[model samples]
Target chain A: MTVVMKMKDIFDCKLLMVDDEPELRKMVNEILRREGFVKIISASNCNEARQIFIHEKPDGVILDVSLPDGDGFSLLSEIRTTSAVPVLFLSARDEDENRLLGLGLGADDYITKPFLPRELTLRLRAVLSRAYFPVILKRTEKPIFRLGKTKIDLNSGAVITKNDQLMLTAKEFALLEKLYENRGNIVTGDSLCRAAWSDNLYGYENTLMVHIRRLREKIEPEPSTPRYLLTVRGLGYKLTGVEDR
Target chain B: MKNLMKILTRYVLSAAGVALILLVVNFAALITWTTQSGKTVRKNYDIAQIADSLLRSDGGYTLPETARNKIETNRQWAMLIDNNSGTVIWSLNQPSEVPQSYTVSDVAGFTRWYLNGYPVTVWKHPDGLFVLGNEKDSVWKYCVTEPMAIMDNAGVWIIIILILNSLVAVLLALLFGLRLFRSLKPLAKGIEDMAEKRPVELSTCGLLGDLAAGINDTSAQLKRQEAALSKRDNARTTWIAGISHDIRTPLSIVMGYSNQLEEDAELPQSKREQAGIIRRQSERIKTLVSDLSLASKLEYDMQPIRRSEIALAALLRQTAVDFLNSGLSDSYDLDVIIKEDAQNAMISGDEELLRRAVSNLIANCIQHNPNGCAIKVTLEKTLGNCSLTVSDNGVGFKQEMLDDLNHPKNSARLENHGLGLTIVRQIIKAHGGITKFYNLAEGGCTVVLSLP
Candidate 1:
């Protein structure tokens, strides 16, 4: 059974935002509210953030690096001592050191200031879902991709059709796994070769082509025209399904 | 140290020259004094010739007219003494105070030295001894004798003495030259310190003390100027960082609200389009702020690079794929070509900075060609260097822009071209790489980044 995370469930998650600026807090709260989140709490300083964090037990956090009383890094450390809630740092400090430090301190994501509202919401939702929904992330491990009439099960390394069932070699399975992961996007030939050979694509160009042909024969309904598996000229190969862009 | 050696050599040479001049002058003076004395003796009568001219005639000795004339003209006297009797046998032009006769010892003393206070020269005669004497107190004479061995080796002795004198001159020159070098050594070190921007302090209590003082003053001035320049650079970088930081929150507000307005269903299409423009411009401001801060940081070496080994072909492919997946419009297309041999090419660099460099190249191509363009990114490994080329089939760069990029000091024109290529150059330079910008012949512009 395919288990899907409901948008309502994602909206129901509680979020805590800690920032020194009042307008930024209000704006973030408004943005989250517009994105269908209902329970959004805010703290203007480290002390207030600590108090709210302990009392409300927020499911996710949007933190700023510089707070009035103390910085968010220590606050995150304090939060981590008691909880594993997802924390994303939103700050005006765009330096790489600050970002790395924030992420090193167990932040789920770091978004610099002057970010688009859509980007902010999307990152916040991703962090929330990652922390709360393990099954949705695990679904990728046992994914089933369809190429026309063929059904490829990545977990079992099986390609089943109406006429017969075929098994994929270990190398072919690794190659298809990479292509399926970037299903609608172009995956370069070098990336595919590395996936199959665990090495560079220097001497494996012809071998990659042969493996790709074999893969097409098994999965593509018309291997000659390659309806499912397509090659982007001079770039790479792109795997597409009936539903993919 | 080489300069000190030169000084010593010049000093020794000049010292040797002075010694040579002194020797030449002394030799010339000796020659002149010897010649003058010899001429004076010759002007007097020759004693041996006078003795030979004396002959017994008519029971008396007679002197020749030439000898008589020589003695008269010089106011000198001549005489001849008998060997057995020790008597004055023949005399001419003799002073009245002269003794008429002499014992053998007296004859020996007067003939060898003086007679009656007259300087005399004696020569052996056939009959007895011959004597020629100047007037009383008219000349002074002394006699000297030496062993034959010393006289025979006189040339060797002279040469040894000359060599010793030269050695002493050279030794003294070296001593003085060493003193001067010691005094100037600190000044040389001080100049080196000044060149390296280190503090310079020299002792000012020697022959070169005034020079040391001047160098110290110059170093102080240079240090002050250096400090002032660094202070100004820091202020520039800090001010840019502060302004960029301050602008972020307000820009974020504008961007967030405009983005919301752009997506609001209640807004009219035209209003939404205006909101979109505002949002887009705010985004541009955001990028500009970051770019300004980054450029300032790079200029001041404030940006620390976090280096790691990166696969060149993989990075190029990933960047192209990201641009394509990020909704690069249908108007634009990008192709990544990795040479077969270059597939394994790797370089050590800061991945984020390199990615930014590549992204800026692609963005520059797109920004300049608003209508649309095809960007080709090719990676190749040549002579152990990874070469990445980004080219576009659109309007090539203007000649002015190319000139600005080629000579970055013409930064005034770069303001129009933006900091995109400047940052690329800086990033590549930081990684020990080079960047080239040129217009392709087939109506396109290409930027090639070569990294070792």
Candidate 2:
């Protein structure tokens, strides 16, 4: 419940949406505001987008690839020169080349045109989470973490106490991260499986259990009687007594 | 053609004719000069006086001034044999080995053939036949010696003749080469124009007339092919553009309104579900549009790789993360295995294309194995190549799917199978890579992408 409150606060961020179609901008604007975005600015072309961007200084940007005066990619590049603010591209051209070019140009994400309303909102939230707090940084390698009497170094991918160091595989680390992301909250088993295996989450109940057992042995004071890593039975898994944001 | 060969033979015949004329002229000059020089040598012989002196025969015989002067002027040697006395007489410039005496038979044999291997003229004498021997330098020397000035003049004339002959030969060879090149120049120009993709027309004349005709025909055929191909390509491009510009905008409007209705709290639950269905169907349509457009572009090789240096390990990791965040699946197991060295392995490729190629493979696995599956993505660096292997633990692809993947045309009946595989093959090929599908023995499917 507290996590939901925190997410809603983050959702109330300001954003800039740029598109050539007036209907698209209006629709995206209404959707974003309804999703808790407070101050949303809209632009029909790159030139206007740039002006609004500089003046409003929105927290993030959702830019269309094609514009009247210039391209969204050029606008992103131009904005990147001055700031590292998050920029997501909305393009009708969904070719691999275009997507790669957009992301390679420093845009946070590339979404093809005619995207689902929920999908747009979710991507916006993801970009905002990453830009403000860098959730993705911790996914690969986070800072030092304290767990019970042990110290977990996310950067080194090593967990060490006074006497010994523990090794964690990439999958194990991701599983631990899902729990850490929702610290003191239950992350459903399905969510954990999806985070670990992506789309192949079914029939992985046994695999997830095995990884959880191994993770607990390294962090818990007793492998047989787990302490820090706990199961919520009908729910999923949770990690307690871990210092997480 | 036979006509061309006949015209070419004339060049060889004309050169040969010049050589024959020079040979005849040289032979005529040699005969005339030889006869004239032989008359002078006979007049200078002075045979009467030489015989008188030999007949004096006092063992102190002396040659007359005329005969002595002739010998001195001619640089000749003389010898006399006394056949009646059976003795050899005094000799001038005689070899030391010559005997002083001779028998009748010896005198007869020496005069008839030679005097000590020298050319000798015989005359009737009282005691012995008077014998005048030419010098032994040639064994059959000419009695009339050539003057020093005449020998030098002969050498100069021989060199001038050789120089003239060489100059004429060189001039003829150059003229032949120039004529050949001029006749073939149109053919060379036609070949160059064909290489440059330009319209070519060569005048079919001279030796290469047939070759010129062949080349012009080939050029015309190739131009026609190029025009037809570009026309088809432009039509396809316009169709794809239309799908993007015309269809997606209106689709976006329909999707936006439906989404708004779905989100309306006041709407009844069933009405909201209906709106949700509309949005879902619209999303499906959007996917189909993107797939069809990209597939067509790939089918005709319209897409080109835009290359950049990519750290492959990072890409693999990012791909796995994106799949997880895509929200497309909630019931699949995905795992990534990256070799230690592969973390820094880099290759030049189109990153977006590679990303899409890999994502498509993973998506295909999830789509096919609806119930559940375990997908493993392994990134490893081999000798000079990087391989990305995506394997799944589920019901592998059917025989028909594998066949279509390998040969797209064979499975034209299969709707999405051909399109997806075509895009995969095209993207990988554009990056200078290869893709393969294998049914693992463990009842799973595997796709290996190797890029240099």
Candidate 3:
């Protein structure tokens, strides 16, 4: 009950969904369609997801962390660079560092694998509410991509507190950047390793992961059950800010 | 074969020890026999010499019969033989018509026969006359220099002593054989204990303490190994527990999401998106669980590594290319270099596992590098062995950071909690190969896998 209160009212917006699994895509589409999300589209893979994005022009998007042709995080980044659609990373990479990297990349919030539908909805709404706040409310001067009081500068690759800038290693910075870029996609270990080091993380990928954990410690509000960076098991990490994945 | 060698070694040592003791006793007996026989021969020769000289004296030219008779009376029985002919020239207290034909030939035959086992001696003269005598009473001639009484007793005692000496030697040899065997019994017992995996308590032989110490040390080592195995079992249990807990948490979440989607009546699009998110998260959880479980299985699984003869060079090329394609990075900008000298390098390994391991390595390379980074994969074959090396020109790890790749050290860079390389190590170890990760000097990391 206490965790649920953390959810904030988000901007009421349209959303799109993409995945290879048709049943999954349809189920998600149906769920969102009933939640007053008018624009809900489903895609099987990267090709379909691209098509849907081009066609729908939705305010927010939900993309599977993994797709047939490519990963969802890259799609999220591609979308973010072009369109400021609030992207929530729905990924299977449930490791802590994976989620941290997704958030570091630019994702607002991260929801791990096997999350409750309600939890996902609540998280998405909170992220959207924070992302599309009215200008007057924004003037209250809270930093963007904040976890509690800590501020993450997604662009500058800097984490700012009340008075100091936290130190970050190269891998930490890369992990953060990857999360920030996706903003709302689950950045799986594979995706984060790819995004951070530009390859599939093999045997020593944990090295990059440790750095993310350290980064999380610096920027995360609680550092446990992280708000900005979240783990999605088996698939990847995700930054939570956009619609539910 | 080892058992056979051990038995053989035991037999050899025992036989050698027995043979050594027998050799020393036999040597001493031979020395004593030689010394005693030499003394007896010398004494016999001395007596025979004295008898011969007395017999050779010219008594044919004696002063008178009266003097000869007087000498014979004083000496008990003195007989003189002819110097040139086998005849008795003078006899004191002789019977009339006494056999004068008892000559040197008779004495010679009797002496040769007696020397075989009897203590009789033949006294020979250069003049051809001879005399044979027994110590009790001289049959032919008795020399004045010899005391007959003393000689008779000494001869009897000498025969008795020779028999006693031979008996004693045989008895001593039997006793020594028993002692030698008793000394060797401990060695045999030690070997038996070793076979049974029991402690070998060796009695201290003056010079054998070193060997005993070696046996004790071996037993200590075995105990240590047993202790280590128990510790390993404990660690394995802990690993299993950790895996179960980590996997269960995610599964519950996935189940919760499914239940929500089912119960909620007018699920809005936003709620549906959340469900989709929940479903994807579940999938991710399942994958991590499987990976962790796989790692645990690899640790304890005793099943032999499934091996197949595969063209390793081709596999490397294909795996690398597949990994490159799977990477999220833009491949057009990255420069990937692969070098292979082997046209057909055949290796025996689990194909699916090796491929997966290679894929993971390639994926790591792609993730670690920036856009347009150069990567190299090399496959080489030499002397019935093969090597595959993957190197990337990316942000190479610091010396200290690279040290923990395969090494089980807890480091900051080792936080992925992924069993990717752990699986790689297991797979390679199963194939009787080794995998090593190191940082490149120019810039990047290199992973080398070698098989024999």
Q: List native contact recovery per candidate, as a fraction of 1.
A: 0.66, 0.37, 0.15
Superposition error at A184 for model 1 (Å):
2.2
By lDDT, the candidates rank as 1, 2, 3
DockQ of all models, two decimals each: 0.54, 0.17, 0.07
Q: For candidate 2, what is the lDDT?
A: 0.75
TM-score versus the correct structure, for each prediction: 0.87, 0.50, 0.40
Considering TM-score, which of the candidate structures 1 and 2 is the better prediction for this target? 1
How well does candidate 1 reproduce the true complex, by DockQ?
0.54
Worst 10-residue lDDT window, candidate 1 chain B: B409-418
Give candidate 2 regions above 4 Å deviation. A1-22, A35-89, A95-111, A118-245, B1-206, B254-276, B300-304, B308-346, B376-389, B410-414, B440-444
Best by lDDT: 1
* Docking category of candidate 3: incorrect
Error of 3 at B38 (Å): 4.8
Clashes (backbone N, CA, C under 3 Å), per candidate, total 0, 11, 78
B58-142: candidate 3 lDDT, tens digit per residue:
5453334544443344343334456666576654444443456455675465445532222354344554443332333333332
Ranking by TM-score: 1, 2, 3
